[model samples]
Target: MSGKKEFGTTADGKQASLYTIRRGTCEADLTDFGASLVAFRTEDRDGRLTDVVLGYDDVRGYEEGDASMGGSVGRNANRIDGASFSLNGKTFCLDRNEGENNLHSGWNRYEKRIWKTEGVSADGTSITFSLYSPDGDQGFPGNLVISVTYSFPEEGALQLLWRAQADQDTVCNPTNHSYFNLNGQGSGTDICGHQVQIFAEQFIPVRKGGIPTGEQAEVEGTPFDFRAPKEIGADIERADEQLQLTGGYDHNYVLAEKQDRMRRAAVVFAPKTGLRMEVITDEPGLQFYTGNFLKKQKGKAGAVYDFRSGFAMETQYFPNAVNLPQFAQPVLRAGGAFESATVYRFSRVLP
Candidate 1:
């Protein structure tokens, strides 16, 4: 099933609409304001519906609250060291929002803008949002046309698809930043108790300002190891330089090489709810953030969200890939098109 409703008005007086798509009892609420997944409701162990993803009840909270909550981040999803990159021998400078580095393409964020509703599937299981970025927008060179589709393709699964083409060669790495708490958004619980397992054997370590140190360090014998399911709080407070550097798990994990484009990236399970979420993506890296910076802020239905209240599994190309020779570049050639897909498969596991 699918439907649309008025979410609220943007600060700029633009009307923002919310679209809902459902498969069985599981449903996702998406907003045009950022083409974001505002809420995802699925059944728990007791067969009760629960909203797993975190967000506000209105569009204002999304605009004034956490900038990345359930947002579709784009143009370039992660940081660019020195706030600049050279493309085809031409250097392009970007906004330095995070010290001297550019985080999420600086202030001209795609997550804060409203996207055009390309179309909603007749079967009410999919919807697509489109956006146009002119050349020099946010210091990126390209007349880019992008589309993001949110769909419930099957029972217990939500898939996100991204497609884009640029008139000029440019950097294009997009990802969905959705903070998830399987205990329910209003459960007033932290995700520290959730068990997580990432398939990556290596991870990128960062220095100050969260820029990659340009090395893919082994996860073996380190706190970053997650080949087996373990509590998120396990070793999170250990005396480790990497954990202390970002205040938690904020670095990118180098996904193991796979011949298939679509592969399992990570798995997270909430014992309290018996809800298991498996992240599958085609991207080469998975950024596992523990919500280390979340302050005590009011969220949906007056729920107060505090530190470690939620976590994000962002699938994308490696951070600073545009500048690092060792990493795969995110460059999209002129007149060329590319597509990326990620699926969040959910199920109730019996404890």
Candidate 2:
């Protein structure tokens, strides 16, 4: 089933609309503002439908909120060292939203903009939102056209497909920043107890400002290790420099080399709800972030979200990849097209 409704009005007096798509008992709510995932509900082990992702009630909350929440990050996702990068021997400076580094493409975030509904599946199980960014927008080259498609192709899977084309050479790396709380967004419980397993042997370490140090450190014997299923809070509090730098797990894991097919990135299981979420993607990096900086903000249904209340599994290229020659470049050449897909498969873990 699928339908649309008026969410709210944007600051510019533009109307924002919400689109709902459902299969069986699983439902997903998305909005035209920022092409974001507003809400996602699925059946837990108790056979109760539960909203598992965190976000505000309307478009106003998303527009005013600093946290990306369930926003579709774009142009260049993640930080770029020194808030600048050179392409084709030309240096371009960007908005330094995070100290001297740029985070999520700075204040002109894609999440805050209104996107056009390109198409909605006839069966009402999928919707695509598109946006156009002129040249030098956010200090990046190219007149970029991007689209994000949200689809429910199966009973317990939500798939996201990102496609973009640039008229000129530019940096383009997009990802969905949805904070997931499998125990239900309104449960008011932190995700520390969730069992997580990341299929990565190494992770990128960051400096004081959360910019990658241009080196991939082994996760073995370290607090960053999650090669096996373990409670998220197990080593999060250990006396480790990496953990101390970012205040918690906010680094990117080095996924396997580029593959023609989708690869399993990570798995998260909420014991209390017996809900398991498996992340699959073709990207070469997976950013596992615990909501360490979440302030006590009012969320949907009078829920107050605090630190570590939710987590995000962002699939994309390495952070600062444009500046790091050792990492895979995320440059989209002139007139070139880019595409990537990420899927979140949900299931109930039987006791």
Candidate 3:
């Protein structure tokens, strides 16, 4: 019969399913719970393979939790300062889930809600997950319909294609928050042995509350430099001003060297497992968060993920773009369409 339609009742009775895409040697397990990514597996240089990202064992974790990893986030992915914004002539208030800031569109955050899946390919290599957001569901005007496609090509790459359209004027910026560990999930803490290089020449400095300061500071001399390969924890705990302000490396890096279209943003590698991950995106900025807040959380296989267990390089226009006029706007006016791309190409790198 067909190779297990990718969509079926998971081990748990919550309508979860596994999806396999055919671009490379990748298989993405997606669940309707939180529209979450349950597992993303790929191989390395020696043909030894492993699951290289952190995710829940079932649907229950996503439906009632907030770790946010490997799940879709928001009508507004990041944050809106003070939990309010004035657009056109009217001002709207959002759920103050995090202090005075409204994050991930509030209450109706995709990371915490279920979505309906559609169209599973014969061999189980392509699948689509979609959700509809009603007018003012999260205090944002417009009924928004969002869809994301997961596909793997002949060469082994996992691509995320994001699409959204709204009927009324509103703001929308959605992103997947997947915590990746090239050495494989349930491994251990500290990505100390992994080497990374990002194409960013500058970075956004943040405040004590983790909000951007609106200034694009150069990443050359500081610990933020990743233009060349460097260990993630090399200068992480150094007493630098930016590092001190945000408690760790949780800032936005401005990707450079664009060729007028999509470009390479960052590369990550795990020396022990021979696994390497390359991120390519159309967005101008990439947020590098070192998972500085893991706080001994129990993850897959009952493994305790300590601080810096996994990291994320989320490509986007920018955070708090709604508050910063100079930054690329995240506003999608009525009748406007929003499109974005993020690709995580995996391969095993050996010494």
Listed in order, each prediction's TM-score against the native is: 0.98, 0.99, 0.92
Q: What is the C-alpha lDDT of each candidate?
A: 0.92, 0.93, 0.76
Candidate maximizing lDDT: 2
Predicted structure 1: lDDT:
0.92
Residue 35 miss distance in model 1 (angstroms): 0.4
Residues 1-351 of candidate 2 have per-residue lDDT tens digits of 589999999788899999998887888999999999999999999999999999999999999998999999988889999999999999999999999999999999999999999988988889999999999999999899999999988988999999999999999999999999999999999999999999999999998999999999999999988999999999999999999999899999999655356989999999999999999999999999999999897899899999999999999888999999889888999888899999999999877
lDDT of 3 by residue, 171-268 (tens): 87788888888878888747867899998889888776677888888888999999999998899889998898766787878874221367889999
Clashes of each: 0, 0, 12
Candidates ranked, most accurate by lDDT first: 2, 1, 3
Model 1 worst lDDT run, 10 consecutive residues: 254-263
User: Model 3, which residues run further than 4 Å from truth?
Assistant: 1-14, 22-24, 256-260
Which window of ten consecutive residues has the lowest lDDT sum in model 3? 1-10
Q: What is candidate 1's lDDT per residue for 1-351, written digit by digit as tens?
A: 589999999889888999999988889999998899999999999999999988999889888875499999989998999999998999999999999999999897999999999999988899999999999999999899999999988988999999999999999999999999999998999999999999988999998888899999999999999999999999999999999989999989998432239999999999999999999999889999999999987889889888988999999888998999788888889999879999999999976
lDDT for 71 (candidate 3): 84
Kindly provide the TM-score of model 2 when superposed on the true structure, using C-alpha atoms. 0.99
lDDT head-to-head 1 vs 2, winner: 2
**On TM-score, who's better, 1 or 3?**
1
